[model samples]
Each structure stands twice: as structure tokens, then as C-alpha cells.
Target chain A: MDLHLSERHLRFRDELRAWLEKNVVRPWREELRDPTASEDSLIELRRAWQKKLHAGGYLGLDWPKEWGGRGATAVEKSIFEAELVRADAPPILNFLGLSLLGPALIHHGSEEQRRRFIPPMLSADEIWCQGFSEPGAGSDLASLKTAARLEGDEFVVNGQKVWTTYGPWADWIFVLARTDAKNRYGGISFILVELRTPGVTVRPLRQITGESEFGEVFFEDARVPRANLVGQIGEGWKIAMTVLAYERGATALAYSTRYSRDLAALAHACREVGRTGPAVREKLARLVVENEVMRANGVRMLANLADGKIPGPEASMEKLFWSEFDKRFRDTAIDLLGPGGLLLRSCSEARPEVDWAREFLWSRAETIFSGSSEVQRNILAKRALSLPQEG
Target chain B: MRFELSDDQRLLRDSARDFLAAEFPLEETQRVVEHDPRGFDPAAWARLGEMGYLGLTLPAEVGGQQLGAVELAIVLEEMGRACVPGPYLDVALAAALLAAAGGRERLLAEIASGKAIVTIARQDAAFAGEAPCGIETANGKLRGRKYFVPFAAEAQALLVTTPGGVYRTDAPFAVTPLPTLDPTQRFARVDFDHVAERMAAADVVAGLEPLAAAAAAAMLLGVMSRAFEITLDYVKTRQAFGRPIGSFQALQHRLADALLRVESTRSAVYRAAWCLDNADPDAALAAASAKAYAGDAARLVCGESIQMHGGIGFTWELGLHFFLKRAKTLESHYGSTEVQLERALAAAGL
Candidate 1:
């Protein structure tokens, strides 16, 4: 197999490198690390970076130009992601909506819906959150209990959605609710609802990492118009599947690219701490080797994206790789950091020390999200291997 | 860039698979292991020579096919899958070093053609970047002892490292069985008292260790796939709780973790092979990193295979033990995983 990048791809990479050098705020990372700076300032910095990235035509690189995308190939998009990681750019603020919902909408949304919703998201003028997971429906998403009843032109919704990323900051939330109670999946509908609506309430849920990257959103008879439907009624399940496809494919790769860089830095730190003994060296070598594999696996999966949409089994394979690798890699870092790892993350004085202790805590949830390792495995076994459904 | 195999490489893999399936199945491999001193059938070794795989990496002038590391990896991967017993890894390594050292034209061709067998007499337990001390050259004679020597019972020539340089000896040497944890490959301790034929040009540790590490990693990839395939097959059909146990989430998740390891091993192996073939600046680092990962990769895959197969897999009749033993055996070859990791760290400038 050819491992060398094409001349055109290399050129694209160079151009993107130049753009990153110019647009990324100078000393941004050091400032982000300044423990005195408020988290709100960090959020604002990320938002501004997202705006600049969007203006630079970096977002939606694979989406059709008709939908305000750059019309880049899968490999080109992969290269963009690699460059972003190399440049140490801040995490994009609208990742959930941009990578998952934006693609799903372009695939399933009506022309009216697209025209009304696409530009605001592209500009980050309206942040979005997903309303899918509920108290009852964690992995068995089709069995969700969220219900919507039609009243004239509107659907009155009542449900509680958990793990809604960006919920606190979201201007809007794309909701999944059952329009017909008789069926688990076939009667479901996809609807978009305003987060600031009269009956909607948002509550942040703190994760083990001591930050609420996601939250829970409660809807009590929130009125959303029928026009907000993604497709016809009974299409929510299909639309959700589409969103998840992108989530586990290119989106996962983006996360992995950053994770690997962090891993490299940890390795450097390990070498600095005189931990390069046989056991430690071997552990670091394994991480380096496995990181390469994880990246290669993602690239292979990305190459197989059909019509810019990675299928369920392919995406599941990648999600399984990154989530598991992230956990093991970070834990290894924690062990390597040793006593230095014991410094609590909130202690600003320890920023000069390796910041891996925080990452080690954060990595625990990677396998729990975007489908837990169990769910991803079931998908791989049932769909990819054609195994019988586990009872 | 593509991560898939080239058209020719794919064809080579398919043909190797078919050939191994017909002539060197697991039972045949076990039979050869039990009955042969060389650890492989002489006839099969000749057949490999005829197919040009014995010298797959050598120059065409030396009667080899002159293929690169990817092809070598493809062949070795097939060999590992079938659990083929042989000194093929030794042969390939010796041929590479001899050619690199220069002025061993005749021996190179002989090894490539299967007319001669050569194995290492490692001065240390593994390739530890240092040759043994007290090696002396007196009146053009060499003296030392090499341990854990593979195929010493039948090798026509023994390659040894000394303080002066790498030396080759066709002179008589003593061979004794060194009991090993692996049944697939036999090992011996070869003692040399004034053995002759010093090859002044070769430096054994520098030229051969990297290739050896890369080959070991390639073989690990094979063991991983075979173990994964067997476990997947077993879990799919073996029923528990009135359903195929593969349907169980715990087993599924375990299988998924193993699958990830297998994929990671494949990636590392391929990249290392590519690096070696291209003579990239980072070839040594890639090889060490690959071997280190392969050590874990094989352990994880083979261990998972047994756990997935239930009690029957542990029995000798079942094939899981073969994979586990072979994987364990190869993990310490050339260098242990720990040693390889240290090499990788050193290469990374630690």
C-alpha cells in the first residue's frame, strides 16, 4: 500500500499549516493554562478560534460546497485534522453540531430546514446540543421514553435528556422523541427545539474530571413546530444513526489525533523524569506503537467513508480503538508521572509539572461515551461479524 | 496514502496462504517439530528455497528474489499462522548481515539456495548491543560460547559476535539442547573452541538485530490474526445460556479489546516492515517499537483466545496452546520485549 502522501495533499497540508500559523492566537495555550484565567475566558477563546476556523473554510471540509463546505476529500480532511493537532489549536467549540449534526442535516434535512439552519451553525452564531440519551435509554437508544404529542401545528414534548454536550451553552437542541407510543423505534420522530424555550431547563452534570463538558436538559411540554422535523415522522432512528456514523469516524479521528499528541508529550515528560528503565521504556514504546496503529486504523476507516458518511460497523471499529487506547495511554502516563501525578489538577502551582493526572481522570469517560465499549463491541459483533444478538 | 496491500503483495499473500494450507498445516508443523533436528522438514525447506522465499530479502546476485521487508513480512506472517517449524528467521537474518558485511558471496548464495544452513551464536542471551568479552583471535582461530542458539544441531555455519568483529565458523562445534518454554522452535547451546572462518567485515549487532526485531514483530501479527479468528469462530458457535456466547456483552467487549490489539499489532508490524524495506532513517526505532508492541500484542491476542475458548482450548488437542506458546517464545527472541523497548527509548534519544 502507498504510504506516501500525494503532492496535492502535501500542498494542501502546507497551506493549512500557514493558515494555522497566522490565525491561531499567539501564546494561546500558555494563557489557557494560566490557572488564574477563568474557565469562561477559556470558553470565549475557543469560541473565537471556532469563528476564525469557520471563516477560514476549515469546518465542514467534506460537506458539499452547496452547503457552504470546502468539498475536500476524506484524506484531505484527515490531513487537516492532523495539522490542527500538530499546531496545538484549541478544541473547536461547535464540534458536536459541526461534525455530527451538520452532516446529518445535510443528508436528511429538508431544503427549507437547511436554508434556515445551516448558516447560523456555520458561523457558530447558534451553538447546538444533541437531545438523545435519556435516563432509560442509554445504549438501547431505540427504547427511549421521551414522548411528543401533537397539538395543532406544534408537538408538545416531555422528557429528560442526559449527557447533552454543550447543553448549557447551546442556543438550540436537536431532539429525539416518540410521536407514537406503540412502537419502540418506528414511531419516533426527529425534532429541533430551542433551548431557551419557556418549558426547557438546563442543568450541568459534573464529570469525574471535575468539569461539566456535558449536561442534562429537561423538557416539560416544550412546544416545537412540526416544521422542525428532520425528515418525515418515524425517521428519528435513521437520522440518529447517521449522526452517530460521523461521530465515530472522522470526529473520532480528530479526537484521536489530539490524544496521540498528548501521549507524545507525556512520553517526553517520562523521559525527562529518569523513568526510562526497561519497564518504563517498553511501556512508552508500546504506547508509541499503538498510537501509530490507532491512527492508521482511523485513516483506513476514513478511506472507506461512503458518500462522505462512514457506515455503522466501520465507525464502531474506530470508536472502539480510540476510546480504549485513550484510557490505557493516559493511565500509563499517570504511572510514569509518579509522584508528580499526585498533584491535584486544580492546584495552579503544579501546572509546571506534567498535567497528565487530569487527562488520566478524563480518559475514564472516553470508553463510556459515543457508545460505551460494550455498545461498540455489540455493534461490531452483531453487524460486522454477523454474530447472533446477545440476549 | 493507502493502508491496504499492494496488488502484488496481496497476490503473494494469497499464494503463501494456499501453499501453507496444503503443505504445512498445523498437524504437519507439529509432526515436523517432533521428528526433525532442524525443527523443520528438509524437503519443505528445499521447497521454500525453490519458491525463492528463503532468500526473499537478499540481492539477486546471491540467488535470491531480492524482495523487500513487506514481502518478507508477508511470508513470515504466513509461516507463523501455520506454526511452521524452521530456521527460516535465522536464515533470513544471516543472509542479510552477510550481504551487508561484504565479501561472503559464496556463503550468501549457499544459504539462499537451501544448500547451507546458518544460525546465530548469540554472545548474550539476547541482542543487548554488546558482544561477549574474552573473545580472542589467536593464529586466526576464535574461541567463545554462544547460548540459546536456534537450529544449532543442523546449521552448517554458525555466525557469532566477538569484540573484534562478526565471525563465521564452519568448523566443528558442540550442540546441546536448551530446554525452552516454546515447543515450536528448538534452541541449543553451541560451544566453540578455536573455531575458524572469521568474517572481518561483518558487525553482527548493528546489521542483523534490527531485521530480526522487525521479523519477530511480523510473525506476531500472524499469531494475533489466527488467535483472533479462532476465538471469534469459537464464540460464535459455542453456546451458553441457550444462546451463542458471542452474543454475551462481556465476551463481546473482551473480543473487542482483543480485536483492537490485533489491529494495532498489524499496523505496527506493517510500518516497521515498510521502514526496514525503505532503509528509512528511523528503521531501527520503528523495528524496536514494533517488536515491543508485538510482544504485548501477541500476549493479549493469545491470552484472550484461551479465555474465549473456555476449558477445551487449554487442552493439547485444541490449537490455542500452540499460538500462545509460539507467541511467548517469539516475544523474547532477538531481544525481549523489555529489551526492545529500551532500544526504542534509546533510539528516541532517552
Candidate 2:
């Protein structure tokens, strides 16, 4: 009945906005803009920024207070995210760990495991990477070939994981490895493997965006302590599903604000295109309407989440819808950009290189990652709609 | 912030659904669509009048429940689901304008009681938003021909739009039904010759134009939702290729895509409705977005619903095509998606 944020939440947003505005510095801004800037320094500054956010009690807004979170309401978290986007702050360096692994651990990990992982992730002291997809296993993650064998008190892991975001920077990875190869899905186990262990080699891959934000991780006889196992050895499918559930939950829900900003910027860019044909105008106009819908839909999704049910098919549906929208949005932005679209990096203020070209390339990855649109549709068909699979 | 309906709102919506389900079954709706001259069952209008739903948004002084646009939207959604045949939207819109323009309290009560039918002959369809071309006015009397007047035969009170402003008349005027893509609603052309009525300087209808657009879109929301449910039901039960057609991935994905539009349309309409209730500055653009998206989405969902249903859907008895017709009607009722998109773009200062 009400979509307006409460006074308390608005106050929280204002406070957070003030803190972010005061803390995010000019140097960090320049570092993000300057392509030649050193990556390590940017990472360090971002890590420090996460720690600063933590020190300000801004981290883990939705986690229960007993587990070091503010126990914030879903609305507050939604507002917090909106504020973060509004400030144009650098993306939290330990994003995957904080949003994905931390929530999964909080829900499925042991008390000791939670204590061991949650704090470091909160402080950005330990970066985490996901090792679910492999070269051969993508949409069909159940067919993953990674194997982990228990030897004495350790599990020796050997596998190659592709599209591993933060692989080079991660200190640990919660990987889905086959423990019971005989049972395709039931055999998989969710194992927390440290990247520092011997045989763990992280190779960064150059992306279409020409940045190494993600990499291919090679694990050969990587030793993981038995204590690192989250839940049962053969129950990783359920645990991995939980991780995916989180991926499609608040983190997925939070993309709308950033999308709204991107859309606004694109609308601004769209006006600069001279002699725009009717086709272009129609596309631009459609994008505007869709952008508004995305914002509204995100609010609806958050409301559903607030009702205290782990989002089900709706999340997957959103995952399918928004990622597709993200790509089309960037494509339209480029189409309107004309000659400027071809520039690998746009430095012109009228059309920022990073915002347009780099973004268009990055948008290509949206559909490929986080359960591709095809996979999402399949999930909707099989799980949500209870339809039979074609095998 | 709560985005879902409240318990009270849900009750309002459910009651409307229950009433529509019982009073206006597909058979009855078909009769209304095909045979009824007024394009709706008279008894059903009386039933809604008894329930005080006709005056849902009218003020207390005017015998209305004083509920906001959200209630109207919820009721309209159920109307679409039931395929309720009537000039309900035209009536609701006319009530809104009359409430704002004032000096129509008695008429508002009649509308609230379903004792009177009123419709806004605004700029819509062939001459939508166009200032009247040959409108002749002298001594507070009007004479002109109005195009695409909704429910002209049924309405006892008509708020006709002209270049000067809005004028009201209950005096006699010639009414001629015209061919329309949609059979569930009636449209007519009215020729006016010295129909004695006073003109009023009213911007209320102009102010509520976006909301009027949004209301039309809300109807599409219901139409698509029901269409989806019907198609889904058919796909689940109707066997093809030795199994339920829904089991096919192509069909399943197509249905899912349709569901996505349906879901997004629901969101867009609700948000647009919410903007109206809260008086958000972005109301105009939000309404345009709601109208534009819902029209296109419903067409896709309704058309695909028929395609998925196959031969049975193509038949007249199936009544699936009514959704397509109704969606097509509402799509161009206030304005086509392209027209609304331009309105939105202009509102956004593009």
C-alpha cells in the first residue's frame, strides 16, 4: 500500500549519504577514471574504504545484530543501497564475499565457520571468489567435473574454474566440487578452499571489456582442511542453490538503483545524438519506460523479500529480466553514441569512455554470468513453472 | 515502504473478484459483448451500484467511498479478469473530472448509485487530445460533432471536451455506433445541434489525463493477467505431442517471457497508480510508462495466449480472443503506446 520510505529509513539514508559524501575522496575517483592507474593501489584504497564503512557500522545492514550486522529492515537496506549508488562510491572490493559467501555462510556454515569468515569478509581482510562454473559446465552446473577427494584430514581439490570474479584477488573460494561423481547432482559438495593452499593457481583472463575483473582459477591437488567443508559433503547442490538464492536475492535486487542511474545517463546521452531517426527515438522512449518499470519492479521484489520468505522463482525471473535489460540498455546507449561508440575508451565529457564503451563491453558479460538468461529461463520453466525438462 | 496491497485493499480486490466471478461469468459476459446494445449487463451495473463501487473515488459529500486511485486500480484489475463488460472506466474518469470541476454533487450521487451513466468525451482515439475543429459556442450553448464518444448511448451525462474547455450536457444529441476492434465496449459518434449546456473553465480533466491513461493501462493489466492464467491452464491440461504443451521448453520459455511482461506490467501499473495516490512529481511520466508498457505487453501476452491455445483459442466460443480485442481497444483508447511514449518523452523534456 505504501512505497515511500519511512522517516527512520530516510534519516538512515541521509546519515549514510552524508558519511559516503564525506569519505569518498578525489584520489579514488581519479584512480577509477584513469585507465593507467595501478590496480593494486585502487584495490587497497577500496579495501580500506570497506574497512572504513565497517568502522562506521555501515556494513552488513541486513544481517542479524548477533552476527555483527545492524539488523536493518529490508527497506533500510534498500535505502542504504540506493544511497550507495547515488554517491557513486567505488564498488565494495569484497563484494562477492560480503553479499554471497557471507550470507551463505551465515545461513549454512557452522558457528566456527561463520565466526572465521564473516568478520574478515566484513573488513575486506579476506576476499572470496565463487568456483561454481567450469569450462564445460555453465548453464548445466550439475555437470561440473571438479573433484575433491578426502585424504586423512584434508580434501585434495583439482579442477579448473572459469569466470571466477576476483579470482586473482581472493584469499579463499567456496567451490562446488563433486564428491560423489556417481550421483550427478547429489554428488556435488560446497567446499571452502583457500587460494593460498599449494596447487591453487589463479590466472587472470582479459575480458571483452579489456579488464581483468574476472579470471580462470586452476586448482591442482589443492589441499583444503576438512573443517572448511560447509554442510554435508554430498549436500553441496542444496548449499550451492542457497548461494544462488542469495545471488538472486538482495544483491540482485540492489542492481536497480545503479540501472536507474545508467538509464538517466543514457537518456542524457540520447539527447546529444543529432538528427536521431524515429527508430532511435522509439527505442530511447521504450528504454525510459522500462527503466521506470525496473525501478518499480525492484521495489516490489524488495517488498516480497521483506515478507520473510527467501525469494523463489521471482528472483530468477528478475535475474532473467534485468540482465537482458542491462544489455539492451547499453546496446541502445552505444547505438545512440554513433562514432563515439567505437572508441574503446571515451574520455570526452559529453560521452565518457568508461561509462559508454567499457560499460557496453561489460554489459555483454551480464547475460553470461550469474546464471545466464537461458539458464534463468530454464530455471523458471523447470523449477518455477514445474514444467518437464527436455533432457 | 510496503509495495504489496494492504489487508484492507486485498479484501476490496477479493470482494470485487468474487462478485465478478459470480455475477459476470464468461457466458454472461459473452452475451453482453455480443447482444447487449449498451455493451454491458444492466443488472450487473445495478449490482455494482448497490455495492457503492461506482462511487469509489467520489468525496463523502458526493456519496462516494472516497477511496483513492489504488482502490479503483484494484477493482479495474478484477474487472479485466472477469471480462466485465461496461463503460466502467469512462464512468470512473468522468466521476474524477466532475468531482474536481465541482457543482455536480447531485450528478455524482446518481453515478455513485449506478442510477446514471456518465462518460468523458475527451480527445481520444481518431481525434485524441485534438482541440475541437468546428466547435460552435454562443450564449453558453454548444453545437458540434464529437468523435469516438465512449458509451454515448448509455451515458445520461456527457462531459465533452472542446477548444475552450469542458462542457456538460444532458440534452438530446444524435448517437451512432461505429465499428470498433473491441466488442466488449461501445463507441459512438455524436452530432450536436444547439444542445443547451453551460461551458466550464476546467483543467481537472487535463490534470487527470495521465491518470486516465494509467487507468486504461490498469485494465490491460487485468486483461493480460487473466489471459495468461487461461493460456497457462490450457497449456497445462491440453495435451500435444504426447504430453502437456507446457512441458515443451520452447512453449515454457515463451510462457515465461509472457509472464515476465505480465509481472512487469503489474509493477508498472501499481507504481503509476501509487504515484497518483501519493501525488509524486513523476506522476505524469510514470502514468505514461504504465500506459505505454502495459499496452505493448498485453498485446504480446494476449496474442501469444491465443497462439498458445491454438485452434480452440481461435474459436468464438473459447472467448480468448476477447482479451486480444479488449487489449487492442484499451491500447488505443487513451492513446496508443507510441503516442503515450511521446507524451512521456515530452514530459521528461526530451
Candidate 3:
């Protein structure tokens, strides 16, 4: 089977590259790297950048034009991501809403919900956070104890969502709450709530990276309009599943592209340093091969998704490999850099503060955040290997 | 772009599965492993020949089916599933090498008819120096010792790789059987002492190295896939804690990972095979990655399959040992994981 892109796709890629080169500038890059940048500044910059993308018809390229998208093919989407990484543009702050929740709402949400949410998401008028993981329910998400009770025309929600990235800045949150507690999966419902609602509190949690990029969102008697409920009653579990599929499915593209670029840069830097020995070179080569494998796997996954394949449990393999590889690659970069790699972003002597050190620290959560590597291994064992299940 | 198997490939797989099941069942394999010249049934080889599998991927002009690598891979996978006791991989690789070398019309014809057993001898322990330590060629005479040559005792023609080039020998070369981890795929140590033979090609050594590695990778894919299926079947029916173990999340996740590894390696091996067939520039890299990934995956899955099966898996009577042995042997056959990694790195220009 041919792995090369078609002529038309190549042309499209060139066009996208040209566009990104012209549009994506150093200001956006500078804004993203500014660790002490105010949350409002980051939010404003993200909104402005997203608005520019929308105006340029790049945002929501995979969605229908009627829904404020260019309706581009998956290949085009991959090209866009690759070019975006190459351009070193600002990171998308509304990834949860744009990639995961927005897609789920498009598929499972009511017509009104779609009309209300999709446009705002595309325009960056609204930012969203996922309310899936809880204290006791991370990988075992169905065991979530969040509750939402129907009351007249609204639902009173009360629950705590931990590890909610950018929760403090989100304008809305799509939550999976237990509406019918008798059945685990069947009892759940997906609903959207405005973050400005009364009794809703968001407390930013300090991470090991010393950044408050994520937060704990607590809802106490918070009211959500009944119209915000996605799909049928007690169908939140299905909606959540759909969102998770999108999340896991989209992972191969974004993660691989970013890491591939990072890997290339790291290799260049190591060569420039000229102090890396044969062992370091061998380690670097291994990471390169792993990166290539991940890229191939990612391309295959994307092709399968484009062909309407659900990817099912195989996504776990991609997740496991990508996260683990990220950590290892970053660690290898650090080791190769030696003392120079230890320099923090705030340190003047730090060898290009944005190089391997920041990456090493950031990669700490790669496995832990997106369902720990342990959980991923469990998925691979049970779903892929068909092994005898442990009691 | 098209990864799906063709109709011919599908039929090849089905027919291979049916033939192996009927002719070379596990009982027959056990018998062959216990008391055959090379631990493979001759009758089974004849049956495979009669079914046109011997020359499944050879050209029609060469007295063969002329199918593609995908079809060959399908058949190989079935053989793996059955844990079929034969020298299929060795013969197939020899045929491919002969085809690439371009002057072996007679041998190819004989192999297509399943009348000849051939294997490539390329594994040299000493990889450095002007010439490898295992095999040497000087003035058309080949000498040196070849280690762990699969089915070497039973091979009618030995395809020996030397620093000078690849040479084919039908004459009596010293062959000593070596006790191997996987008896089903028997091995032997051979000492070629100035054996007179025709040098196949000047660049045959360089050209055939990757092909042999790719074939070994494909064979391992077959083994791992079958082992996974067997493990899955056992896990499904074998009860633990009052329910089928397959129902448990822990086992399911592990099995899923195994399936992913197997499937990914399957894809990689097939891609490598395709690269060989098409003579793609990326053939070497693809072959290296395929071998490296498949070797690791096979070892891991095989070990886990035994662990998941509990006591029965570790027993010889249960037959899990057969595949485990084969997996371990295959991992070190073409190239060790470390060697493959080095090759992969060089191929990637790292």
C-alpha cells in the first residue's frame, strides 16, 4: 500500500504551509512561552488567534461549512496540524471544547445546542472544560459520583471535577453527571453548564511544573437550563463516551506532530552541542526511531478514523506509546544536555530555557494526565491481547 | 493507500489454514518435532507444494502462483496459527533471494515444485572485519562455519552468504544439528570447508540480508498472531473467580495491548514485504523496523500468554511451550533486537 500523499493533498499541504508562514508570527510564539503571562492575556491572545483562524477559514476545517467550518478532509486536517507545529504557533487553549466536547455536541446535542455552542466554539466566544474525571473516578470514570437532579425547567448540579485543564478560564463546562444512580453507565447524562452560574467555584491547583494551568471546579446547587442537556435523559454516558472517543482519536495527530517537531529540534540541538557521546547518540537514535514509529502509527490511525473506523481499544496502544515515548524522548534530551538541561525557564544561564528542560517537566504528566500508562497497559492487555482478566 | 487484503490473499489465507489444519495438525507437529530429520513433516511439505503454496509468491513464468507479498504473508500467518511444523519461511526466503539474484532459474523452478528444500545461511556472529567469521568466499570456494541454520540438515541446497558474495551449494557441506530452543523449527551448525559452488551474485550478500530479515519478521508476525488467538481463546473459556477471565478488565486490557502489538507488527511486516516486492527505497528501513518491533512484540506476547494461562500454559502438554519456544527463537534468528535497532537507526539516517 502506498503511504505517500496524493498530488492534490501535497498541493493542499503547500498552500496550508504558505498560509501558516504568512499568518503565524513570533508574537504568538512569544505569548505562549511567557510563563508569567497573565491568564487574561493568554485568554485574550487565544481568542484573537482563534478569531483570526476563523476569519481565515482554518478553524473547524473538518466541520461542515454550515456549522462555521471549511469541511476539509482528514488529510487536510493533518496537514494543518503539521504546519501549525512547524510554524511554532500559540497552543490552542480551547482544545477540550473544540476537539472533544464540540464534536460530541455536534453529534449528540440538540439542534438548539449545536446552534448555540458550535459557532461560539469556532469563534472563541466561549471556552469549555471537560468535567469527566473526579477524585475516585479517573480511568474508572463511570464510578463518578457527580449528581444532577431535574427540578422544574432546570437541573441542579452538585459535584467536584478535578484535573480540569483551564477550568478557571472556561466560560462553560460539559459535564457527565449521574442522573440515574441505579445503573452505572446507563444512569449518566451529559449536560452543559455556564461557568458564571451561581455557586460554581474554580480553584486553580499548583502543578509540579509550578503552573496553575489546571484547576478543581466545584458545583454546589448550580443550575443548568434543561435545554443544555445533550441527547436523551440518562444518555450522558453515551455522550461522554463519544467525547472520549474524539479525545483519544484526535490524540494521534496532535501529539505525534508536536513531539516529532520537538524531536527534530532536540536532535539538531544535541548535534550542535557536540558533547553527546556515542551512548547519547544511540539513545537519541532510539528516540528518533520511536518517533518515526509513532508517526507511522499516527498516520495509520488517522487514515482509519477518516475511513469511519472507531479505532476502538487500539487507541489505547497509541496513547500508551505516544505518552511513554514523549517522556522518554524528553528525558533523553535532558540527559544529553546534562547540566545545561537542568536550567529552569527563569534562569538566565539555562541553555535555551524553552529547549529540553521545559519539555521534560511538561512531559511528567503525559502518562498521568491522559489515563495513566498503567491504565493504558490494562486496556492494551484486556482489549488488545484478550488476556485472562484479573479479578 | 490500500491496506485491505485482496480476494486472492483472502483465499490464500483460508486455503492455507484449511490445508495446515487437515495435514499438519498439532499431533503431527509434535511427532515431527520428536523424531524428524529437521523436526518438520515431509508429507506436510508435499501437501503445501500440491496446494501451490511453495511458490505462492513466485512468478507464473517460474512455475509458481505469482501472488504478491500480501498473499504470501496471509499464508504464512495461517501456518503460524497452526504452529505448522515445516521449513516454509526458510524456503520462501531462499526463493526470494534467488529471484533477486536473477540467475537461479533452475533452483526457482525446483523450489516452486516443492522438490527442493533451500535456506539462506547469513547469520555470522562476527559482524566486523573485512570478512565475517562464519562464512568466507575465495575464488568460488566457500568456507567457514554457519551457526543456527534452520532446517540445514534437511536442506537440499544451502544458500550461503559470504563477504565476497552469496553462493549456492548442493555438495556435501558439513552439517551438525544443534539442540535449539524451538525444536519445531530445528537448527544446525554447518562448516563449509572450501566447498565448490557457483557464486549467485556479487551483491547478493548485501541484497539478501534485508530480505531474510523481512521474511523472519513476517514469520514472527504469524507466530505472534496465532499465539494471541490461542491465548484469547483460553482466556475466554478458562474461568477464574467464578467468571470467564476475559470478562475482567485487567486481562482484557492486557489482551488488547497484545492485539495492538500484533496488529501493528503485522502492518509493519507487510509493509516491509511490500517494500521488498516493489523494490522501494525504504525497504531496508521498513524491514529493520518490522523485525525489531515484531521480535519484541512476539517475545512479550508469548511470555504474557503463558503468564495469563496460569499453570496449564507452562506445561508441555498444553502446547503453549511450542509457540513460546518459537517466539524466543525467532526473536534472535534474523537479528537480535539490538542489532535491528542499530539497523533501523542507520536506515533512518540518525
Native contacts present in each candidate (fraction)? 0.55, 0.65, 0.31
Candidate 1: docking tier: acceptable
Error of 2 at B161 (Å): 1.0
Question: What's model 2's lDDT at A83?
Answer: 74
What is the overall TM-score of model 1 with all chains considered together? 0.93
| Interface RMSD after interface superposition, model 2 | 1.8
- What residue runs in model 1 are displaced by over 4 Å at the alpha carbon? A251-260, A267-283, A299-314, B126-134, B200-204, B240-242
TM-score of chain A of 3: 0.93
Per-residue accuracy of model 2 over A256-332 as CA lDDT, tens digit each = 76766666666666666563677877887888788777777887776666656556888777777778887888887
lDDT of 3 by residue, A168-193 (tens): 78889888899988999999988888
Which lDDT tens digits does candidate 3 get at residues B1-350?
Answer: 44455576667677778877888777777777887766776766877788898898787887888877666777777777787876888889889878877767788888988888998877665333235455666776777887767788788888887766678887465778888768788777788875557656657656666776777777788788878888888878987679988877767767766776787786677777777778878788778877778788888998888999998888877787877788787777777767777887678666
Ranking according to TM-score, highest score first: 2, 1, 3
Docking class of 3: acceptable
* Candidate 3 residue-pair clash tally: 28
Model 1: residue A292 alpha-carbon error in angstroms: 3.4
DockQ (Cα-based) for each candidate: 0.49, 0.63, 0.31
> Which tens-of-lDDT digit does each residue in A344-371 have in candidate 1?
7566645353366677787788888778
lDDT of 3 at B102: 74
